[model samples]
Target chain A: MATASKAAADSRANLPFVYRQYSAEQLREVLHKMYLIRRFEEGAEESYMRGLIHGTMHLSIGQEASAMGICMPLAEDDQITSTHRGHGHCIAKGAEVKRMFAEFFGKTTGYCKGRGGSMHIADVAKGNLGANGIVGGGIPIAVGAALSSKMMKTGKVVVSFFGDGANNEGAFHEALNMAAVWKLPVIFVCENNGYGMSTSTARSTAVKNIADRAAAYSMPGVIVNGNIFSEVAEASHKAVERARNGEGPTLIESKTYRHRGHSKSDRNRYRTKEEIEDWMSNRDPITLFESELREFGFIDDRGIEAIREAVAKEIADGIEFAKASPSPDVSETGNYVYTEQA
Target chain B: MDAMVRELSYAQAIQEAMAIAMDMDERVFLMGEDIGVYGGAFQVTGDLVDRYGADRVLDTPISELGGAGVAVGAAVTGMRPIFEFQFSDFATLAMEQIVNQAAKMRFMLGGEVSVPVVMRFPAGSGTGAAAQHSQSLEAWLGHVPGLKVIQPATPYDAKGMLLAAVADPDPVMIFEHKLLYKAKGPVPEGYYTVPIGKADIRREGRDLTIVATSIMVQKALDAAATLEAEGIDVEVVDLRTIRPMDKQTVIDSVKKTSRLMCVYEAVKTLGIGAEVSAMIAESEAFDYLDAPIVRLGGAETPIPYNPELEKATVPQVPDIIAAARDLVKGVR
Candidate 1:
């Protein structure tokens, strides 16, 4: 009877999820990053509306927490593969925002010299593989990166970010199965922002939750509050640690909502205005983080105002840099087609 | 002053060149489905795994897409990987990796990366491999902007072209005819790199210029020999590389001969012959031509498994001889 009671007590003790405490400095840094991403995207939207941007852009307006939280645990050597909505991921992963802005502006000073435009910005130095336009394209690529890490014994992990809609892709299943069989050090993070384009998750996927799909691959699957930066950060930390320790890949479902339409061209007819207003007002990640930080005595009204002003200035500087950069030389069209031997 | 020339088959020459390259460079590795232990489906890479060991001579699963992706990734990351497709027909499975990623990566990335990868395919009909494994699809790859396409006809060109392909910085696709591997010619020993995008005059004559690729080169040479007996001396030009095609050499040969006949094993519709014919017609060589350019190619149809049917699907030696004879005679 005494042993049974002791076991029951231990089970109860492990029931509540333990969260990692953040200091004032850490909280401020997270807020600053979120504000920067928000401002950058907002500026991009204005530019697009003004006919400055040419190509299709999928902005990560409301999914700031997932990018910042996941990237917070990654080192400079760790790699990540992103989806089309990759501006936030790139920013959080420490890419120069000015270069990213220049990329969107189609300037030679952009990350890819304007060749990649909005969909394919990659910075190898920052360990960002690149953003992919093809659905589920980056899953297997991340697996390859993780395999390279294992083979080279670099102890580096790769994180692959995809949308909820990508779960239906054959590559998703194949990549996850391969990663599982080989115990690849990768993290499969699904940003389930309710819809994959105009198609809702309920209509496309049979399973209620994307996390449940992990059982097929026999890996650890967890659902987290994506709008809450602390929750996302803590969950990502555990997953990254597990992968680094050779425990194989993990599937994380970040249940969140995108405040904007899927892309710049979306009419928002699939969902109601009421749904958008509710998510924006009640489930806003930035607002939630601000309230939490204020409660923890980490920030006040003046600090928030200063952060907003600084972000505004950063956006303005990025635009100026992009406008001043030169276009790529047309004569060098055949350059770099192949690597020349020295 | 010339040494005695010996005859060799295309397969033997490719095998010899691969063996030599492996001996010369430690970084060069070959991988394909059943290429290692099976010696390749057509035996082009005979006993390579045993000689170079498994790490360098890898046998992969039958996943062309996955295998090509790995090769491209490895090539970009500092390893020189040579991939073999058991048959050229299977390349469709890897078009995404080849066309989209390998061909566009360096350009899209601002020239920061290089795909120094070589893919070899046993192309054309002759084998009773049916429609699934006996088509010549080099024209499809040549149409892409960044890829280098090479089709070597003679054993000597095979050896030299492969060496050049290994040395080149870009991704090169070498389409080897299944029937030509057993054909023979004299091959030099040791490290020799033939310049890519250069045409070679196999037979120098004045009556007409017969441009050919892969197996058609032998046929063109045979036709040239036959035409000489008929008092019509014909020049045969072997276009080793199709993409960065040797337009100058081809035009020079046409200007000298005044008549042109482009031949290939691929379908006549938009084949390498079409590109060569168009180039000749557009160049200064057009004014010197005594006869209109003629292109002889495979009929547009699936290569049937029946031996006779398969042989009929592609351009044969007799077909080239007849075509060259007609061109020399100014026949429509």
Candidate 2:
């Protein structure tokens, strides 16, 4: 008798179905997060090229929207396991840009206290399990975390992020089977950028869509256009809800592209420059999202300009924060080897 | 609440320690291959499944990499997980998780989180599991900085050390000797912890310090008993916790005895005995030593299935007796 339904009733921003009914403000926040990731990566690359950032880094310049869309549905307590090209994932998962930059600069105030550098960045309080250096390394860990949730009856889910190359690893099959059998609450998100380093997915992976392999494990398999912000959100929403309701795991393959070479060492010899340009010009996640926002009258030119300036300032502040932070003391290097403090 | 002390087998001791840990902490759970229903490969986890239920005593698929990774992940989050490898040799499959993820997460994450995970490995050469199954690879894990490698020799140490390992805030690798599972000793009931990174002197002597590991501790003590008739008092130090290598205990014993003999079941090259020998050489014990440091380790080859070859490969009671007799009689 009482119609207290408030699913989409608490919104004022006139945004359409691209985000499954996310209001204009929520859409703007998504765009903001994506911009932060994009600029953070550019800042990192610039520092690396200038010899300010130590060690090599893998940049996810083009795969920004996939990070935002997938993590958008997750709650604050939800967890994610990221890959080597993890800067975008970290930012989209809500990690502070300053600490991330500090980590890359090898400062004591960094995420890993200057020990992990780029590949092993983590924020535990934010429920990020940690980014892995090994391919397919975090799949089982995600499954395990999901198992802990199920065992404790906590009703929390975990999203595991990996590249296309990791699907070829033995851990992929093993982890999927275990998660399937137990019906653990985990989402295996594959960002298939068509390449695992230099080799294309065509050469390494025999399957057409990485999600199709999910059928073997008796789970839902869906593929989405990774560049489109709303499509990624729509695709992952069903899986996240199903996992939360205790259905099982889902394998969602978001088809995206990387604008830059795999790592700083990549020569871009695997794919042509023209092909890279084609993907960049047409399928850029930020550009398409901005165009969609204009079409829907959710945001205007001034809004777009203000958001860009703010992101640029935030990234510059992160760089300055990293540059000013000091290196860890040599004597303190041995302190964290064990949890025991004597 | 039972305070009465009773004899428990090495496997029983380890099982009791795990049971005590799980009962004490709700966050603790066990995961491994066929461990829940099949009672594990060696039956060390025989009755844990029935007692803890499937949720806590989980039976995992035959995927060491996945199981190990899951354990590391769970530990990194909040749970205290005890993962069992059917054979220590299978740890090769889990090298990435154990060495890379579990061991390094804390240091790599700047100590924001600690991997309170325990890995139980049924190791050593006595069972004739051969090269694929029965290799004593303690040295390989000990070489790593973040791992705490412990080879529990007796029933008491097995239970106490396992409880201690589960309580530890870091990854502890428990190398439970396959041969010592059935070996029995007096162990007290209820909660207790044998502090890790410390060695226990099983027997005290004045003539020589025979630093031994795992089952070799019992062998060294037996050898010492036989040498007692020959008027040779041998101090047998059970190097239970291998990674930390309690230098003070070994050094102090060597200083008192003025002679040392290092013995273990692993390969002589880069074995636990090498660390003991090097410790004496580096410490003030070197000046007090009456003779060159002697080490009795496994032969540099795969453990043979042949009974005689297996016995020949690892130092047994008789071998320790011979080594002790010779070392005490000024034999190089």
Best by lDDT: 2
**Residues A116-197, model 1: lDDT tens digits:** 8778877878888778777777776677567666656789988999999889976677678767876879999999999999
Interface RMSD list for the candidates:
2.6, 1.0
- Pull out the clashing pairs in model 1: B7-B185, B8-B183, B8-B184, B8-B185, B9-B182, B9-B183, B9-B184, B10-B181, B11-B181
Off by over 4 Å in 1: A1-27, A177-183, A206-223, A242-248, A296-302, A329-342, B1-28, B45-47, B50-59, B183-191
lDDT of 2 by residue, A70-140 (tens): 98788878999999989888887779999999999999999999999899988877888789999999899
Once fitted onto the true fold, the runs of candidate 2 whose alpha carbons sit more than 4 angstroms away are A1-16
Candidate 2 docking quality: incorrect, acceptable, medium or high: medium
> What TM-score describes the B chain of model 1?
0.95
TM-score of chain B of each: 0.95, 0.98
The superposed Cα distance between candidate 1 and the true structure at residue A305, in angstroms, equals: 3.4
TM-score of the A-chain for all models: 0.93, 0.95
